[model samples]
Target: MRLILPILFLTILSIKAFSREVASDSLANIARNAMFTDAYIQIEGKLHSKKLKVEVNLGDTPEQTKAGKEYSEKLTGKSHMLLS
Candidate 1:
């Protein structure tokens, strides 16, 4: 019984560690993709207004300009939901 208890505890610890590693790897992949993804930017509003709305593409396309206006709008909606 004593031996079983220690083995069980170690097994649980190892499982938790493995899960953490997997989670971290996925997070890293997400970060890497975001960093390399092509992006398009738009600037609106007049300089005199002292404010400008800047937008960028967040899609996985190789060229953001080729993604079309609709693509950006779609991606932006998802991002807005996440921000909210």
Candidate 2:
């Protein structure tokens, strides 16, 4: 019947929307868990107004610094300062 089709369509649409929301929430949780507080990026200067500088201090350890340098270069497109 027409009513049955409409109800089924609405149900399917709602289910799809719910799934998307759940997927987004899970992705957010994953990103939150993966946040690196020790490794960060610092922009020391203004952009277009002054010499824009990017400072990255990955960590105190050498290994951490090395990884931070690589990540910084990748993120900033090889334009910035990486302080160990």
Q: Best candidate, lDDT-wise?
A: 2
Model 1 whole-model lDDT (C-alpha atoms) = 0.59
- What would the TM-score be for candidate 2 when compared with the true structure? 0.34
What's the lDDT of the predicted structure labeled candidate 2?
0.68
Cα lDDT, all candidates: 0.59, 0.68
Clashing pairs in 1: none
TM-score versus the correct structure, for each prediction: 0.26, 0.34
Model 2 misplaced stretches (Cα beyond 4 Å): 1-37, 48-52, 77-84
- Looking at model 1, residue 23 earns an lDDT score of 79
lDDT of 2 at 72: 55
Model 2 lDDT tens row, 2-72: 79999999999989888833578888889888956565677655544335445578788888888878765
Report the error of model 1 at residue 38, Å.
1.3
Which stretches in model 1 have alpha-carbon errors above 4 Å?
1-36, 60-84
